[model samples]
Target chain A: MIGIVGGLGPYGGLDITKKIIDETAARSDQEHLPLLLFSCPNLISDRTAYLLDKSNVNPGKAIAAILRQLEMAGATIAAIPSNTAHAEPIFSVVQDERARMGSTLKLLHIVYETVRFVDENYPDTTVGILSTAGEQICSLYREAFIRKGFVVVEPEGSQQEKVNNAIYDEDYGIKAQPVPIANKAREDLLLVMDDLKKKGAQVIILGCAELPLAIPERDYNGMIVIDPNRILARALVHSLAPDKLKPL
Target chain B: MIGIVGGLGPYGGLDITKKIIDETAARSDQEHLPLLLFSCPNLISDRTAYLLDKSNVNPGKAIAAILRQLEMAGATIAAIPSNTAHAEPIFSVVQDERARMGSTLKLLHIVYETVRFVDENYPDTTVGILSTAGEQICSLYREAFIRKGFVVVEPEGSQQEKVNNAIYDEDYGIKAQPVPIANKAREDLLLVMDDLKKKGAQVIILGCAELPLAIPERDYNGMIVIDPNRILARALVHSLAPDKLKPL
Candidate 1:
């Protein structure tokens, strides 16, 4: 059974689950994958806050505990859908915790799989990204794409801050209001995409799971929106039953 | 945390979760309810087959075990979102299992809450239902509405068989093809509904959660369609915090 480490702000889990639903080529419900969604949002700390040092509490420990629950509940393979949660400060501790447990559950690397997708399909293309301030400033995703021999583009100057505010704004931020996402969030993302386009970016990856909800899959405003959620979903299908996975 | 006893057929869990998302009066992610969906479909047997006595395995024992897992996972209140799951043959065993374990988890009776809603809003009106043969033929729901002083209507003869096949045809049934639900399921339900309208039925309860996905909410061909999943979502919010519930 597949396990989802959800509640990393809640909606990412739902997003990836829906993507998995679409990814599976099934003629019946029994053919659809059996999975468990352990969305204990209260147990998990905010990933962006921990990475930003706004909070000393690292979310990885709680995330590790959730995975243990999923493992105990019969999930052989699991994935955490949040991009920010993949940072050094958080993911390092998650690795430490899992090592201590000797877990048999295979935790898929959301960013690693995504970078591989780009390397294979959009090779030699200029890649751009939109993510939380923590991920961009930490260079977690940028370095991944750079190592793949791809020139990574980022929002320059105050445009970076604008994108961050659009994601973190207390009242209208995606974190503050995930569903019925603020109109400004979409408008701000589109505005940033225009900047990336001007920079000669061939593909813009929605590095954050939350960003994809406001942005479309594949093409948005003629710019390629590479949703890691969709990649992670396909990776999940590939993990257990490769033949059951639909063609890309 | 609210625990959902999902995996009765898998899609029902997704259905109820989405409804809860819609029923929530949240402008932000934190305001949304924290939920755990434990969907182990392979662990449980077919409810319809058990009800028909074609299978000796009772689903309640597995259902009761799932609730225990939910309770241990820190769920204060839990619910099983299947109508047929509440039948005497299954629900009685569920209660026995719970009593034996001394579980504190609250399993919301889907049919009971639904009957209460019908009694309060559409009083004195004939009620029509579309559900799995297990729920209908067993008189599990019929007796409840009868006790509430309402005449219950069901599909006649072959129409009832058609409704059952649409939900469990193995090839085109809802249990088999929940996503991109088979068109025959919707067509079969509409045809049966037309007959109910001719029978002086005032409110048509989408008694089965699967049926609600194929049928429109509130109105279907000008007939009042009562969605139990919507009502159950409201009930969940009311159990936790009534003020948080979006008005009806």
Candidate 2:
């Protein structure tokens, strides 16, 4: 069973789970999988909290609680849908919880799987990374993509601020009109994609899950955009059905 | 949290849970649903035993155990991925489980949901039903589809036996190749789909999940074959996100 630890604003964990289910179902020749969702939007602080470091919010405890509950309910394996949660201390808590429960719940690493997918599928392809400032500045996708032998491109400082402001602005939420912010984020992503395409990128990776919300299906100058969430979904499907995934 | 009443087959529970996760992850905007799978294929009886009425299978008790475990683990609703287990005493057992736990776990009816999907999506279209003898002879899809104002077609007596034989034959399992028995099953399904198309059927519903295994993407004389499992996946996606379901 899959367990998701969500509530990272702008990350979109629910979208990740949906992609995983769709890809797996479309590719499999067996029974459809069942799911349980636990959305804890209030459990942790926003991404900006880690940037400022004013008050340390330990997402580990909350993640542990969710995993323990999932294990108690008989989940074989669990996954934290958020990429940033793969940080040292946070990931440690998940391992600790599995230890405590005496269960073999494998916590899937979203970024690691995405990196593997890119390496295996689109080898030597330059990738553009569109994510929050917190992830960008922290170099979340940079090291991994670089190690995988792919060039990772990011937006300029000005564009990065614009993308961050749009995500954090409370007015956008109240107005329910994410168009302006989405447009800015999309523009920023397109710029990165264009630059990478010039550098021989056949595919652009939406390293940030929220970036897809901004640029749903916009074609970037004929370059194929790869949302890492979609990649992770494909990876999970392959893991579940090796025989079916062999051809794809 | 999602609670699965599994062991219908050794891997049925795991398979369904995987689909739910993959589908949820594929969504554009949503948090991943945490899943809890309770796989006890051992709790289920052999199909032969149930069909012959020589033994009894306590699906109610099995479902109850899963629900109670999920409720304790903080699940608000539960769904069983098994299609055939929804008959007779099992439904009552699920109700009893809810009552006993003082929990309001919504157990989803797979067949009912399939009927609702066909009625709403394929409105005046005739449907071809391909399922086990029990499901077909017992009028599982016929009753629901007819009530919703749709024509339902099934295979003839000899054709029905051929379909059943393909599924249970030991030799067929040893050799994964599609043999004559399996081909007959596929032909029967195609015949029903072809007849329904002549009678104005636009879609053919693969009522049995295993049928998809036997006939993977079999073209039914230009009629669109609808795998009920896929429909069920789409249904769950829509149920989780009502606003996301687009006009088909």
Model 2, B48-131: lDDT tens digits are: 345457657655676677677766766555666656666655566668767877877666677888788767766888777766
lDDT on C-alpha atoms for all candidate structures: 0.82, 0.59
lDDT for model 2 comes to: 0.59
What does candidate 2 score on TM?
A: 0.55
- Name the runs in model 1 displaced over 4 angstroms: A25-28, A99-105, A133-138, A157-198, A220-224, B25-32, B52-54, B100-102, B120-122, B132-138, B157-199, B219-224
Query: Number of the top candidate by DockQ?
Result: 1
Residue A214 displacement (Å), model 2: 25
lDDT of 2 by residue, A124-227 (tens): 87776666646543376778889877877666677556555555555542113454554544565566567666766676666555567766673578766767
Q: For candidate 1, write residues B1-248 as lDDT tens digits.
A: 78888877676777787777678786545577888888776678888778888999999999999899889878888888888788888889999999999998887888888888888877999988887746453386788999989998889789989888888798888767867889988788889999999997888988776677677658777678898878887788789877888975
Best by TM-score: 1
Candidate 1 — which pairs collide? A28-B176, A29-B176
Q: Which 10 consecutive positions of candidate 2 chain B have the poorest summed lDDT? A: B173-182
